[model samples]
Target: MPVTYIPPEQRKGILESPILQMAMQQRMQQQERQFRERELKLKEQEMPVKNLIQMGNLAKSLSDLGLDPRVILGTKA
Candidate 1:
């Protein structure tokens, strides 16, 4: 089959057709949703580490004030 050259105006019209435009919008929305999901997963993974660091800081602060961290944090039975 011989490849016929398409005129630029016809190509532009095809690109601007409503069906193609809607498809492009749907593709963009899906990509955005995937990106947000990945971002949420990363933040969820980071939360435990962030909490651990905060706890460590609080323990250190208590120790610096001459308080036993274990006693204040209720580690002893």
Candidate 2:
């Protein structure tokens, strides 16, 4: 078996080909987009917990004022 060596110039040419460059750029952009989407999903998941905490605080405040939360929020007791 003989080992074949690709010349440096040819290797550079292959690496710098437009198609390969475009594919690499697209892959990087896709990875970045996926990362951003994952972050957004996590933030969305966290939002409900924060909302619940805020609602609980508001309900406590209403109770301190002798007001029923359900009445204030227009819900059944």
For candidate 1, the 10 contiguous residues with the lowest summed lDDT are 68-77
- Give lDDT tens digits, candidate 1, residues 1-77: 99999998799888989999999999999999999999999999999999999989999999999999989999867
Weakest 10 consecutive residues of candidate 2 by summed lDDT: 68-77
lDDT comparing candidate 1 with the true structure: 0.95
Off by over 4 Å in 2: 1-9
The total of clashing pairs for model 2 equals 0
Question: What are the runs in model 1 whose C-alpha is more than 4 Å off?
Answer: 1-7
lDDT of 2 by residue, 29-48 (tens): 99999999999999999999
In TM-score terms, candidate 1 sits at 0.84
TM-score of each: 0.84, 0.72
